[model samples]
Target chain A: MLGYIDKIREIGERLFTDGKVDVVIGFAKGSMPMMNEPMMARSSGDLQKMVWDGNCGINLANYLTNRKEKIGIVAKGCDSRNIVTHIIENKIKRDQLYIIGVPCKGMIDRRAISKAVPGEVTEVIETRDSIRVKGRDFDETFDRGDVLQKNCAVCLHRNPVIYDELVADPVVEQTGIDRYEDVRKIDSLSTEEKWRFFDDLLSPCVRCYACRNACPLCYCPTCFVDESKPQWVGKGIDDIDIKTFHFLRAYHCAGRCTDCGSCERSCPVGINMRVLTKKLEMDCKDLFDWEAGLTLDKRPPLDTYRPDDPNNFIK
Target chain B: MDFMGIERDRLHLSWISSAEATKFIDVVGEVTAAIKALGPNTNFVKNKAKAA
Candidate 1:
């Protein structure tokens, strides 16, 4: 994974020197371990700050919304999909983007490592298949597959769906993976059990909108949670209000969500909000035979109406 | 809604013309029965005491 940084810098340099793009967006090593932050390199000198690794989990496409400048962005499989989503939604023009695609090999779940280790992790070293974590009092090695973020573990699209430049050859996409196993487990639960499941799942949320802010698709100027005209939801952290916020947010992304796992990653409380979105994603695939952001041409199922559209929900 | 444990019958959507009063009445009856069978919606209802 570390080897990709040199190639990323090489591409950023060419894009800057050739005057093809005004800025190159990529990741830089964060102050702490497992916290790579997005960095926008404006010149060849700035390219040295760019880095890539399993820690580059935050979706870079969130920064691309409504931008007017010609941008050269580093995109993983999910980020590239979101770029396609942005173009389809007219958030940014396709011609203005110089996509630098990176074949992803899943991002590390820092929380899992934190749980496994005895102390705060100060450094994380990644090789092809092993992760070495070092902390104040202890050091440990873990297989990469065991600590991958849940979405990446079952990700079927490791190769970017669209790109102008490839950092390396596309990695083999995972096949025969049951992406919706957890969703199916929840689906089989009784009504009361399901209600309690989400209640417990979301009880820790402090109404911090990190999940909403991290999602590339949630580009609304005034999110429903903040609107006070009719006061759709209460300001306090009431149970119903929290449920309303999550439920409506999931509904909004029914067909548009790409299962990027940004929401889950950004949540301070570590709530797996992906369960709600993944349920909707499963429904979209089962009913409409559609996946989000695979192509630039086709409109999302929710965006267009057809005579054969499924109305099974209607009484 | 059903996935989140809201009873599937709690919300109903249908198309009926203004002229079709009979169809409207039938749909309303169905909706009423569905909700009545599920009892009061205790899961999502805001707790008045907590809010106050």
Candidate 2:
């Protein structure tokens, strides 16, 4: 994945010189290790600053919402899926994007690395199958597969589903992965146990809204949390309010989420809120046999209605 | 709601025509019984004093 930087720059430079795009949205090295930030390059010089590595986990699709100018976006599998969702929802026109597709190998879980290391990490180096972490007092290496972000570990669509250009050949997708094991465990719990489980899980949240802000699907102008007309949720750290916020946010992403893990990646509290969204994703698959952003021709399950749709829940 | 630990029986949805008063009464009785079986709603009920 480190070798993708030069190819990205070459494509971005050509796009700028040809006047084919107004900006190229990609990733630049972050000030800290394992924290790459999204960059929008307007000139060829800015393209040189772009880089790609396992640390580039932030979804670039979050930057594409409502943009009017032509964009040359560097999209991984998840980012491309979200871009397809954007196009399906009319958030951005498909024609305005020139997708430079990347075959993703998965992203590193910085939190996992922090937990495994004894001291504060100062540098991270990755090869094809392993990662080396360097700290002030400690240096360690671990198998890359062991520290991948939870979603990426179970990812099935590693190659971009939609693209105008390819940076490299599509990588082989993973198989035989049980994607809903956690959701099933929760499903088997009693009502009281489940409630207690979520209560403990969400106790660390400070209502910072990082999960919501990091989500590309959370593009509503007046989010329900902020609306004063009906005052749907209180702006406090109350347990019930926190649960309500997470529940509603998960509901909002029901049939649209692509499991890009942006919400979990951006969470300051390290909450795995993807549990909520993934449950809904699993239900969408079980009931409607659907996956979000795989195609542009059909509407999402929740967005459309049919006579034969599942009605067992209606009694 | 069920996935979040809320009892599935706590909420009910049914289709009844406006003129079918007997069906509505029967459905209401069934829904009431289901809620009664689930006991008091203790999970999501916001504590007003704590929030304030």
Candidate 3:
């Protein structure tokens, strides 16, 4: 990943030197194995610590959503989509941000790594090519593509859809992998079965709000659940409260979610939160035939209506 | 007026995909035409006195 490091250093130096940005938010080598830590560099000296490689999987856009300061960011395909959504929703100003777009084949999942090689993974060594995990007795070498996230298997874009700088040559093969099949299968289930699935899925949520906090699209001045007056959802995980949380989150994200998949990745309990957004994505497609974050000029689907839209709600 | 009870000049219909770039333009054209035909959806009510 020397190319990645080189690009980060070059961009960081240029941004700091040119007074283009006050902060550069990128990934630094994490102290823990198989983890990439988010770093905010204020000066060229701190740019030395910035690195990028196969394991820089965590979506960094989640951290940059609300900051008003001038900033630069390292965006993968998914992260770029999140940036587009934020700009469209008027949550962040595009002119204040400089994006260094990097092509990605998808970063490796740390949990998947632990599963593939049981026992203590002392360190992870990743290069511009492959990853080798050092552990008890077995130092397994793996191609970077072999252990990508499930969501990345059918990535729609390898290059950033929007960027000011390109770190590497784009890998442009638009794989037509439909993401709605899982949502469709779940949709076909009986109402009872659906209830059972949600019951199982949300039971583990400790109301930590990590998923909500980590989402870039969830930038609201005041979240409804946090409101004390007529408190929407109580501070516990009952069936009703958990169901309300997911429903409200899904409703709030209607026509606004870009399918960045950070909410799913941030969940410590491993709830398949992508299922919620995937279903919302399907609804937006089927009803309004609109996808979020592609453009800033158009209004969101739920915020507007046509005279001849489906009239199923009429009495 | 058409057989489906919609006036040809008054009605607009479109089929679109999620990724289509030009569909928004099509929808906006149709909606603006429709809105011009029928007045705005809401009117300004400065107060209850204005409503009365």
Candidate 4:
């Protein structure tokens, strides 16, 4: 992890000193444990402050939308995928930025570790295989893979699909994993059970919209939630209102979401929102044989339909 | 979804997992009747008509 941090700073310095990019987007040491903040660097002086580790979970590609400056941004597999989606969507021209790709090892789930700790987790130490968590009176160790974010555990792309340079040798992507096993479990449920399952899942939502704001795909000028003339979803905290908001939020991201886990990471209450997106991703893959952000030339599943599209679901 | 504009009843593609096979048939029967009661799709068209 430390070696990667040095490599990232070295690349950031070169990009800044050579005047190849006006701003560099990456991570900096956070003020608290299991946290790293997205940072923007303009000079080698600012580049010196960059850091990288499992805590660099926030996707930096979320900052690329509508920016005109030449950007040198660090991207993990998911971030790079989001970047591909962005270029395809015309949010940022491909030639306008340099991607510093990081071959990712799955990011650790901070909430999982925090929940496991007996006391406040004040310090987190990471090695290649294990994480040693420490606080005032307790110290515990966990296998790195066991504590990975659910999305990372099932991630198909660990290496950036596109990049100008890589900070390290590409990590092997996961294979033979049933990424939709949970979705299948839910799909096996009756309609009423399925509705109850989601209702229970989303009941704890506080309507913070943190998940919406954290998503790279949600760049709508006036998000449906904010529309006044015919407000698509109400502002109150009613149960159906929350469900409607979440339903549309996931629907809007039908074919474009990269399974980046940023939406779930940003939720204040840890809603496990990936269930909704994963269901759509499964549908896209099974019904259309499509994966988002894998290629620039191909259109997303929902963007185009074939005459032979499956019609088995209709009665 | 574009087919909804012409005839909303044109598509209903569902694959029942073997585990849900026994129950999904009943659900499909209910869904078919619900679609019949809903009538033709005019959601976006009505909005455009109102604007015109």
Candidate 5:
């Protein structure tokens, strides 16, 4: 974890000093326990505040969309992939970026840790292999690998597919992960059971739009929910409206989302929003044999077509 | 659902797991050839997209 911080600081300082970029987006130690706030450093002096750890789960690529200035970003595998997606979708130019890549083992699950703790956690300390969480009354230690975020646990693309330079040697990517086990479990349910599954799954939503805002892929002049002309979804906390919002948001990210897990991480209420996106990811993998953001030159599955693409799902 | 039937080509699906490592290369090769045959996707683009 300290190695990541050192590498990030070194790269950040050089990029800021060399005038390679106007901003270097990285993570800073958050005031709150188990949170790493995203920081935008404009000068080399500001790199002092930058830190890298498991809490650096928010995708820095989220800050890159629609920006005109050149950017230097500390990119994990998923973040770098989203950068590739941004380039392909014309949201940002590849030349405008200086990507310092980190091969990730997967971020620690803060929610899992909170659940594991007997009391409210006041502070937390992490290493490459273990995390120690301290509460007002108690402290507990656990192996880091045991509590990784669900998406991170199943990540196959752990190495940055694109990078300007490396922070460390790329880690071995996880394979045979059976990423869609949960998706398949839900798929086996009856139609009504599936409806109830999502209805119950989305019940705690407060309509904060944090999920949409956190996704690097969701850049539009006006989001569909805010459109007043036709008003596709109601503004109030209507259940149907909430369902509509989630459905359309996930649909919009089809073939584009790198599954960075930012949307899920940003939600105040712990909704497993990846369930929606992962279904599309699985379908894309099954039918088109494609994954998003793996290469700079190839277009996304939806943006391109095949003459003899899979017709099994079609009528 | 939007891209069903011959329209299904517009919504391509692929399922090459990493466990089948050698099969992945061959699968990607085939998909590439087919998509190249179909060329760039203009079927779903709108006039608004062109202006943007």
Candidate 6:
């Protein structure tokens, strides 16, 4: 924990002193325990406010797309993958970014914690050893392993695969395990059942566009849904409109979504947006042996075409 | 109506997932036949009578 703090401070100071970066985008301690709000540090004095712990789940690389300034940011395993995708897409130049990579053991899902403790969770105490949750009723202690994200359970890489400076020692080599068991269960349903599931899941969407806003990959200047003149999608939560929004987003993110789990995290009604992206990822791999955000030099499968490309659907 | 020369009501296409294989193919086949029956792209008439 100290190692990461020191590394972050050191890099922040260096960047500020050298004028390499104008602002440092990282995590800061939130008012609540085990919560990290995305901090934008401008000067060396603001660097003192930075904090990294078990709860820094929000990917900061998502902010890099529209900004034109020289910025330094903390990148975790999944975060770095999104950065890599940005580099590949030419959204942000690598030289403009000071990627301070941090190793992650997945972030805690606060909803899961609240479920376990109910109304007792008054405050949280996060440290290197364990997170102590204090409630009005009684205080409860949860091992870091218990409340962490499901992705972290079978995570192969606890360390960032790419970084400008290493903040901590390499933990272990991550094993390549498919993280789609839930998706598979959902996929096994009959066509009508699947349609019903999707319809029911999206029934609560108010067309607020929060999912699109929170998504890092959804950086299009004018989203198809937002175009008024052509109006690709209507404003109402009709069956066709809702389905179009999901399908369009999934297609746009094909061979691009890093599975950072932000879309689902940011959804207000808890839509399982990961299902669409994961299915697309699996299809891309199966059809083209292509994985998203792994390489900067390689073109995404959709952008390139081969004469011998497999067309299984063709009669 | 006239939307940048290519009509709005006649700009017909449906987006479906591969998981909806049977329905997807069925819908596409039906939509394509309907569009063919509607004739060329310029023949798009605004169905304003049914407008909400």
Q: Please give the RMSD to the true structure for each candidate, in Å.
A: 1.1, 1.1, 12.3, 8.4, 11.5, 8.1
Cα lDDT, model 4, residue A56: 83
Q: State in Å the error of residue B44, model 2.
A: 1.9
Winner by DockQ = 2
lDDT by residue (A169-244, candidate 1, tens digit) is: 8999999999999999999999999999999999999999999999998999999999999889997888888889
Per-residue CA lDDT of model 3 for B1-52, tens digit only, reads 1211122344455666788768867787876877688654221112232232
DockQ of each: 0.81, 0.82, 0.02, 0.11, 0.02, 0.05
What TM-score does candidate 1 get on C-alpha atoms?
A: 0.98
Q: Write the per-residue lDDT of candidate 4 for residues B14-52, one digit (tens) a residue.
A: 656789976698877876776787665433221222232
User: What residue runs in model 6 are displaced by over 4 Å at the alpha carbon?
Assistant: A1-3, A154-158, B1-52
Instruction: Estimate every model's Cα lDDT from 0 to 1.
Output: 0.92, 0.93, 0.75, 0.85, 0.83, 0.75
| Rank order (by lDDT, best first) | 2, 1, 4, 5, 6, 3
Candidate 6, pairs of clashing residues: A120-A135, A156-A174, A156-A175
Could you give candidate 2's per-residue lDDT for residues A199-291 as a string of tens digits?
999999999999999899999999999999999988889899999999999999999999999999999989998999999999999999999
Over 4 Å off in model 3, which ranges?
Answer: A127-129, B1-52
lDDT of 1 at A236: 81
Candidate 2, residue A148: the lDDT equals: 95
Q: What is the per-residue lDDT of model 4 for residues A86-191, given as tens digits with 9 covering 90 to 100?
A: 9999999999989999999899999999999888999999988899999999999999999999899999998999999999999887899999999888877754
Interface RMSD, candidates in the order listed? 1.1, 1.0, 17.2, 11.3, 10.9, 14.4
Off by over 4 Å in 1: B49-52
Cα displacement (Å) at residue A306, model 5: 1.9
The segments of candidate 4 whose C-alpha lies over 4 angstroms from its true place after superposition are: A311-315, B1-52
lDDT of 1 at A170: 90
Error of 6 at A276 (Å): 0.9
Query: How much DockQ does model 5 earn?
Result: 0.02
What lDDT score goes with residue A61 in model 3?
75
